[model samples]
Target: MTHHASDIPDSFLAKWQTTTNVLAGIFDVPAGLIMRVLPGQIEVLVSSHSEGNPYEADEKAQLNTGLYCETVMATRALLHVPHALEDTHWEHNPDVALNMVSYLGVPLLWPDKEVFGTICVLDSKKRNYQDKYVELLWEIKKSIERDFVVIEQQRQLLENNAELQAALQRLTALQDELLRSEKLAALGAVVAGISHELNTPIGNSLLAASTLQCHAADFAVDMKQGLTRSRMLDFVSTVEQGAGILMRSLDQAAKLVGSFKQVVDDQSAADRRRFDLGEMVRSVLSELNHTIQGSGHRVHCAIAPGILLDSYPQQLAQVMTHLVSNAVQHAFLPGVAGTVRIAAQPDSEGQVVLTVRDDGLGIPQANLGRVFDPFFTTRLGRGGSGLGLHIVYKLVTAALHGSVEASSEPGQGACFTVVLPLSAPAPLQKPEVRAVRNGNFV
Candidate 1:
């Protein structure tokens, strides 16, 4: 029968031998055997010294201890048998055919609070069993129990250590994910800054190109009509103007390229220094003069003298570009032009507020809050990465330690205001972009 010791972590078959010869002599048997009851099986640990047939170790015998150990364990009784062949409790056992006649078995209750098995003695001759010999077996059972407890405790300790190791692995994975998120946020902010810095010079070049193109078209007409000396000189003048335009455009372009290059290099390099905010914004807007005129929109700017920031300039450029471009692209529609005002002024407290105002189709109140969310774009598929405002938010909050807000009404136009801290922003542990942008119905 299945028993607790067979499956219990603390249970095991132990040989408690205290002079087997003396044990056999005292028990008046040929063999002194110890068998432990385990779950679904039994283990034979010790066998007595015999003169006749030696009982080999059981390799495949289930404790198959029917009601026997149960009765003795429940009652704590000593089993005394004169002859196994005639005993009603064990006559059916195959051991009866062997020279075994006397069977005295006692349940071993160890002192350490575990049941190792049962101790028994078998004799070829039928002999009356006694209590004194059974009492000696109990003493031996108690001794082995002490050792079992020590070993079992160690096994439990090992299991606990293994569990702790698994928990540490899980914790490490979570920490890695957190680190990755932080890096991605930083990357978004840098992109925003770079976008801002590029807008100005490119805009200036575009204006210069347009002015030269208009002048060249006039000279082209004169050349096509006739090759007069006056026309030739006029053509030369036109060529010189175009060359100057090209040179200016190229120079502005070089500055933009250099700025972008430094930003890219910083990704694989070390820390960068702060930049002049007022200068960067002013330089960028100079290039956009032509675009403003082409779109029939006027730009009114009031940049503070010493507005400055401590951060990667490229990322800050991106933030400004997205905001300004958004104002340009969506500022005017339906034969109606608008005014875009860019102002930067430091308050008495030294905090700088940059405002971009557009008098075009103002944002709807409902959608104003969601524009900055990643992948949330009102433009459908029209060159909108849905990342514009998202990138802006990331830069302002993460890199600049600044806050941005917008207010608008239908037909009244919209205004975006960003407030930057006077000093360098403290690094944040978990920087995330805020959602902004929506439709305003008039």
Candidate 2:
């Protein structure tokens, strides 16, 4: 990692300052310094508190100026100048002007083998530093390198956490989008079913009306020719029969339309209201009638009456729709008959237990626990998006503040039970993703 002088914490710098002060006292030098390497410059990061030390902390000098610390950094090795005035090569170096003739310094390197700077002692008089002194400086260099390792690790950890957070946000966005699409798809299917169902009654009414129109015109023509008593009686009987058929057909159509309108309004608006549990379930089942009939499955609702709830009716309807739809789509085989039963009852704890059970092929034991997971479907490419149960799980737990569980016995049937409070809690600002264990949310 690239680092700057300012990146060094003050705590570490304080420790280095103490080290420099001790070194200066031991060496009896005028200056004991820890330098940091920068672009085209070298800085005195820590300077000793020894009396008469010329270099102060944070002092900078241009690099490649024949400075003793610069040479140590360039070679990444030790440089010991016993006497600068005595050596012709260093006689005109910058330290000579400061009257510092003797130098002993070691290069400091980071864990990545990059230059940090140098640690050294400078004496005003010529002195030959001992081997023990050089070894002690090398020990201090090792300690500083260890500090570099810790800093780099912390930097990498922070970067990794940021990346994980970003990925989680992205996953949440995609899940929301998929959830919306699934709802639209479900709504569209209901519309198609209702349209198909409306065809029969509307067609019957039209046929009856047309037949009555022809009979009325024939009666008028017969009236001009002096109609007989038996003919007039037949005309009155025909009119009565036609009127009854029209009333029944129109009444049936109106009922279907009313049920459709209520279900659609509740689901689309998603408004919270007090409603009868049995009535709501019947409405939802009415909308899903076409789907159940198409699958050759019979639905028997045994919901108790007078069980009212103050909650989001739309979300509850969705839960019912998906659960019933799941049973119809997965429970039976081709040309095989099955029964899906919905039952609900109110408990003493002001809660309701709603169940959807199918008497068809049951879920396998191994796959039972993972049925609620998103994008997990046995019928992958055969018209299953796999979000059906997942959405149901989210709605019950997060929005409705309830719990759902799935149970099955192989070759018998599958059952989904949902327990919800009579009054739902306040809605959350955002849906929470929860873990499911053993086919139930804990």
Candidate 3:
């Protein structure tokens, strides 16, 4: 009853035409029709081109007492009024007015028993219809219902396919975002380390410059008071010393700044180059001197001088910075004197072994294993983003194609050891970025 004639394929409609026409001719009926039922009316779906046929396709009729389909739909069974003219109720029906006094029909059904329509034959004169006529119409009804089943299943499959494609697109988007977040986290850590390293040399240079200016002003005043050989000699010595201090401080700052620029350039390009390991380590230590300037902590380096490597120096610099900074922040309490030692040498296996050891409050044994995990920090809400060690681990293993290990016991301090090939195996890909705050990858 809910079927749309336009939704039925032309091939299926052609088949329906053949079936209805055959049934009409075999029965010698005036009309053979398939009607689709609506809420309050019936419409002709297919009408046979039989002689004297009165019904046309798409013709609408009310579901009243006179209609043959109305009776078939209500009964949900065969309706065979062989002699409607003899029946009192049918004598005044609309079919009788149309000269269709005899009818044979059966209700068509969907699989769930919902009525689809009715298939029937109408004749102008009274005649008895055999049981075979009803059975043939029922077979055609079953065939029509099978086509509806195929359509419904196809619709469901199309819906499922669309949903699957949408889900895959969402997953790809999430993966892209995750890769970007990781790159940003690495970049943030580098910026933080550079900021801390620059503070010391720049601070010392500014102080020395200010002192030198004061000494020059005093020398100017002394000269105006008249010449005295002893005073002049003392003033000259003071002025020379002040100038030396200022120049030395500024030079140290300039060296640190040069190191920073080279490291940044190498990291951004991710290229392999020749570098002296000992000098690089010393430069990094110089930048970090401010961290231990007044904390009573001492830094010791035993790097083998002239030890050179063809590798990514910037990545190595970053790893060293993280290790040293971690010691300053976590290895010791404020004002507590401790020792952080860096040692590097070549191994017999063509690899370089670098160790950063700290004598402070050592890591708890239970926490040592998880130190390199991203966002895993013991100092949450107290200045730990927990990504420093994670970045180190990633660089050593992924970018440098190297290996690292950490060993510690509570109150005995912690030590990190790294072993990398003299030359990197391949150039690293661009880093995916994520947000970082206080050293935590977010």
Candidate 4:
């Protein structure tokens, strides 16, 4: 596993302890040990329970010393000293103090081929270990190395799992940020459209007031010069006509301003209330009139009147806005005129089936299933954020407690149908108050 000597698990330690005890009994030795190699030292990690064993568990000794296990580790092979006292090299070794002269050991290694330590048996009398016993120790060494492989695999899995979780969290945050930006952009478009619509009526009112002022000044001069009955009658006619024009123009301007304010409030506050579906639909279409006309497209609303809904009007309006905008953007090519129709009706189940259909280039069969997927847009890099329809799906299904689907045939047209309950389910908690800051949601 390429780990330090101190990283041994308790389970592996228990297994190694059993191995050491068995080896001591099989070899009929006083001491059987599993040693671990540390930096500049060697540790007795496991020791046999046999009587008269000199070595104890956790006993440490300085490295570079003439010990039997050190010779096995340094040579990366088996070592045997049949009679340490009679040998010229290992006679005065560290274990000689305990009268452990004979020794046999095999080097142990990690999965990466790094030194771990050694497994060995020591006795106080001179004796030679058979070749079969040496082979047995080697087999045990291989078993420990296999355990190291399993540990490394488990560590890698844990690391990979943590990384995946981090990536998922980052993706979620980015999606939220993009959704906020889309909402703010939609609201901005509505504001721009309303401003453009107000210009015509307000301009007409201003012109009418200026004309009336000029007419009154001319009448005063004529009256001072001795006005006739015919001239006074003519002046009266002009005054009546100017007054009518002023009233109509001012009234139209006021209505547009009022509608704009209502839409803005509904979208910003997201308050739940009972509202007429037909009227709400008309207002949303009116707010988007500029974008529709600018694209040479038309939107027709045939929503069933008196079909009321007790739901978040803001969320429903957002759904409508995105649906209509999606049609205007994707349902036709540039400068191509098209028709988008919105219809609604109440079903027997106390639900409303609202649809937005466009008679333009319909969606292809292959892409029909993926139209509502986030960031799935055919018009990449041409002002298509790919989130318009995705936002619609979210609002309908989540906030409004509804179901929505898309259907289309190539060159026929595309339709988005949403079925929503008349009375939405109560929210689990209050919604957050949202505001726009620097063209983004805050």
Task: Give the whole-model CA lDDT for all candidates, comma-separated.
Answer: 0.64, 0.82, 0.77, 0.81
lDDT (10s digit) by residue, model 2, range 202-301: 9999999999999999999999999899999999999999999999999978876653343223122248789999999999999998998888889999
Return the number of clashes found in candidate 3: 11
lDDT tens string, model 4, 82-150?
989899899889999889999998888877788989989999998887788888888988897888787
In candidate 2, position 301 carries an lDDT of 93
Instruction: Tell me the spans in candidate 1 whose CA falls farther than 4 Å from its real position.
Output: 1-30, 38-40, 45-54, 62-77, 85-90, 108-116, 127-132, 218-442
Cα deviation of 62 in candidate 3 (Å)? Answer: 3.2
Q: Please give the TM-score that candidate 2 achieves against the real structure.
A: 0.60
Model 4: per-residue Cα lDDT at residue 376:
57
Instruction: Give RMSD (Å) of candidate 1 vs. truth.
Output: 13.5
Q: Candidate 3, residue 282: CA error in Å?
A: 30
Model 4 spans with C-alpha error above 4 angstroms: 1-18, 48-59, 64-66, 83-101, 146-360, 363-409, 426-442
Root-mean-square deviation of every model: 13.5, 8.0, 10.1, 7.4
lDDT score, candidate 1: 0.64
Worst 10 residues of 3 by lDDT: 431-440
Question: Between 1 and 2, whose TM-score is larger?
Answer: 2
Clash totals for all candidate models: 32, 0, 11, 0
- CA lDDT of 374 in candidate 1? 52
The lDDT-based order of candidates, best leading, equals: 2, 4, 3, 1
